[model samples]
Target: MAITQPEEDIEPTGTKTKWQRFKSKYFRMKMLIWWTLLGVALGIILGAALYSVHPSSVVITLIGYPGELLIRALQELVLPLMVFALMSGVFNLRHSGSGTGRIIRWSLLYYLLSMILAVILGIALVFIIRPGRSRPFAANNFANCNSNVTATGATRADKSAVDSLLNIGRDIIPTNIVAAAAAPNFLGVITFAIVFAAGLITFGQRAEPLIQILEMCNEVFMKIIYAVIACTPIGVASLLASTILKSCSIISLLKALALYVATVLGGFLIHSFVLLPLTLIVLSQNNPIKVIRSFLPAIFVGVGTSSSAATMPVTMKCGEDYGCVPSIVRFVVPMGTNVNRDGAALYEAVSVIFIVQAHGLTLSVGNVIVVALTATLAAIGSASIPNSALVSMITVLQALSLQEYIPDVAVLYSVDWLLGMIRTATNIWGDACACVVVDTWARRHAKKNGTLPIKNPEPPAEQEMAMGVDSSKKDEVI
Candidate 1:
């Protein structure tokens, strides 16, 4: 060996080997995985133990309240950031002057069609899963815990179709902008932001300063978002443990828990694995699996954090890495985070129906349709943050008077964190799908204009060179 060492066998003494590097990297990832697993395990254990010892303890309240507060704080950051980011993105694309019209048309079409598909799929799944029919959950317990019915009010007041439609229209446009911003209606904020950004963009040179300022504000808000996200695991653990301990019973958990879990998981599977991909394939003419693989990390983070807004940066980064056009990713992902709530829609519809059936409420076809539509629209109006579901649910129940039959809002208390996680996952998936659809459209336009390379094009010069073929010979062969 000393006489003649093979060139491939040579090694440097000061540098670490590939195996060593891999080990270091692997250990770091492993530690993170183990830490997360430990957190979840502890949460489950504490939750179960607390339920057994005392169903309603002050300790639970202390932990639960702060966790809830933290979630609200995170939510408060989402609406403005989303609006600014999305509008900025859209304005940038418009200014680029490259197929802006086509991009806008395709994006709008894809968004609307995909949402309709998701709604239909959600309704179908809710009916098929029938998680609510497993057992007749005690009406009083459910009413006491989950009801939106007030003590003095009747729960069964029927509203006409005309009234419901009018109420929806009124709620969409807020009377006071300040009040809306203070409460943080994402849709309202988005409406304001889009008009603001559009106006700023129209001013050209005069708007330059304003655009710069808005961009700076967006950056600052993102920093705040990051700080908030850093605290998520602890907040989630506390929230989950406290909720489980306070509201869930071992008997109920054993009986209806599986049904709840199945319905959620099943709905997610159908949306993520089936409906979303098909939409991408059909509309964008792209490979859905590729989009999914690219978005996996963001999806995981969204599920863990239970927030699409919190996951926005990661989602945008992932979209760019996966070859999504910046214009499309920036516009569609942020907007989808706010409005494209496929998962929330699915979960809300299923949960409402489940609760109703569990309580042995005889729901007519009209009731089911109303619940589905209400859930979908309510989810759209919901702020893109954590723990906003209860508020949104309150609005929906009030509108429909479903709360009259169920008097207490406490039933949702036990599973808020779990449902939040599921909803967040769903929201993230919808955003990813939106990116795919937008990217497909952008790429196709780019290709048509000869900006992007053609798919399955002829071999590059290097490959031809390696094959010992001259340009002239290659042309002749072709």
Candidate 2:
């Protein structure tokens, strides 16, 4: 009776313990969210107040130092995180052959469709809203801008969309893997990880030790990520305060570019809020608003860092809460970080047209087509780093042979910092949605094709035994 009594008592105790843990975790997440929002609010207020005092550049740098450290910490982890996550995720796959291909096809399809919609929407909005029509270009408009900003026109004016595409292909098959990693070429690193994992899988049991090691490494990195995530509120506050301090003179620039800013913000709002959620609803029939709410932490991180790659860790951390399997989140979100740049596409397209309109010039129908297509391609080729789209925009300009107005691109730089954050938030949001959508689609497709295995297929007895429950007491535990 004593033995049976203890066994019987185990179930409720375990259940209660798990419930307590759940509540604790849920409360922690809520607190993190509230604290992060508070940081943003405080940072903005601090920046605004300091701006009136005309703080020195040295003070601004000091204020932003904490945020800079956070960025470096995240950046240092990105390569290892991508490599281990990809390998470990592939190892978890039941059938990498068909399963991997299906996931890739769906990911690409989602990226392509989303980028096109965003680009088309931006182009339509720019033409309809005509933000640039009121702000005709004048030489003095950019006179206050730094020479470096104006000189960006000549920086990458030589690289067209074709060159960018070729570079991407070359990056995928890097000759020196070390050089690629050193260059932090994400595409190359991803290719190497995938191939290495495939080799391990091909060896079957022979590679089990190495695969297990990779899995352990992945878990260790995730633990480290959790630690980093806990410091996000502090980092976000410092980042925002520094950004505002740096752009203290933004009020005049904001007034100058208010219409243009409104147009871009309007496009981002429509795509992220209306179009993306609607797509999630129609495709998966899931409550996307809830998903978006779950992803707020990642979105806020993106805003602070202004880099999708930097925000990738946080995005994946939120994936479980977003109801996506780790495998889908690992594979889809990383790839989306590189290729699925709806926000960049939208921003580039609108910027190109807005620049043209601000100059009191109109593109030919052919040139407009080229701008839209190049913007889409350029965005895909863009690095998932801060202000990379600004560099990639050079390709769109060169494609349409609009090099003369390249210097005019600098005029937009005054506001690029603010716009960069907005676009990055949109990009992170798209990546999160891609994970959910791809996971749902892949499951449905696999089931329809009769390839889906029953989830948690093992019997309760075995599962409990593996979990350290006494086999004789498994029935009672169940």
Candidate 3:
């Protein structure tokens, strides 16, 4: 919690002081979440109004630059943010205690399992929805079919999933770290960061300086990102205006977008509500709804901002308040936000399949598997940016030789505002959900195995929260 200074004790600085005080009071997870939603609602209305007016290119350019700038700013931060934050966590391995190892191991195991499952779910949903199919059959959502079924039934093995898998593996652990950095291979970059950070653990306090610097660098990136993100409403309004004018106004585009929008949002709904909550319940044996409600403030912040990195503070804070051990909440949410974007991974997977289907291409088991792998990579590559998944989706499309279909899939951005919010919120929710599950699983095992010292039992959860419980708080059981 932020400390409050007395009104009389503080010196006034005109508009700056009022702004500072306003930020101090309301610039928190709870309030920011509401502000962001307002931005969305207001932007939508403004966008529609502006489009109706047929604004000139000069007007459009001026209005749209803030939104474009926010994205560009985030793009610049993604690489360094991932590198510093993940490396910083790995460097703290030994000092964070024995639990840190399992936290990393099990958290990662769960992250991959959830992501794989999410992608599979997305793939299955896309198969059913067939968003990228020919407009006549797809517009009413398979109500009348067959014209677009030509490319739906066959699976291609020409590219071979095995070869693609091997190629990705080789790229993950590159021969030259510098070369990987220069080329900006996110997988290899993260791999190198993990290796170097682990090596640094051996130096003990000697590594402290570098770790502190990394932490500072991470903070710097965060501040910059958040500052840029505050302009989201302006950007959203401009993008909405442009999108409505260019994309939604076309009848062909509208028909093409119906199923695709439904598919992306449907995938987000299932992943956010069914898949993740169930995983959290099965692993931690906690009430998934209550867990989500406890962190709803933070999740909504992610929804509003559409950036997980920007939602980190709220997530970490909410996780701790929800009874996650402070250490687990602190480390897990930060690192997980950086890497475990389950929703984005699922979106990427669905987008790739959607594009291929739209292009009337033959389907293959190998192609499906390749998409799954590439989607996961893309999720990691563009983890930190909102509405930025398409950038990495291009990478996946190109890998499968589907790059030429990019223009065909451009309709996605028209509805990306809401789609981005839902997906971003889901991504942040998954991190907090994983934190609770991991904390529960780790502490339960630690207690049984004598690694964790036993303490007083926690009060009833409702009673504790009602009483503002602090002293008797303990990690929940699985």
TM-score for each model: 0.58, 0.54, 0.64
Q: Select the stronger candidate by TM-score from 1 and 3.
A: 3
Per-model C-alpha RMSD: 10.7, 10.0, 8.9
Q: List the pairs of residues colliding in candidate 2.
A: none
Where does candidate 1 stray beyond 4 Å? 1-39, 55-59, 75-94, 127-159, 182-186, 254-257, 272-478
TM-score winner: 3
Model 3 lDDT tens row, 1-478: 9998864344434423333432443344334345455555665576667656666667766665666655455556666766776675554444444324556777778888888888999999999988755632132112232344332233333446677567667767888878766665556776777788888878888887877787678768756655655665565555544444533234544565688778888888888889888898788898998898999998877776677776676787798788877656655676687678888899888877876665455456656776887688667656365555755565566556553344333345546666778888888988987898888887888788986632212323332222223222235322
* Model 3 Cα shift for residue 276 (angstroms): 2.1
Full-model lDDT for every candidate? 0.58, 0.68, 0.65
Colliding residue pairs in candidate 3: 67-235, 155-363, 155-364, 156-363, 156-364
Q: Is candidate 2 or candidate 3 better by lDDT?
A: 2
Give the per-residue lDDT of model 2 (tens digit) for 355-426.
Answer: 776544665554566677768866865556554575567556655546555544544644666788899999
- Total clashing residue pairs per candidate? 7, 0, 5
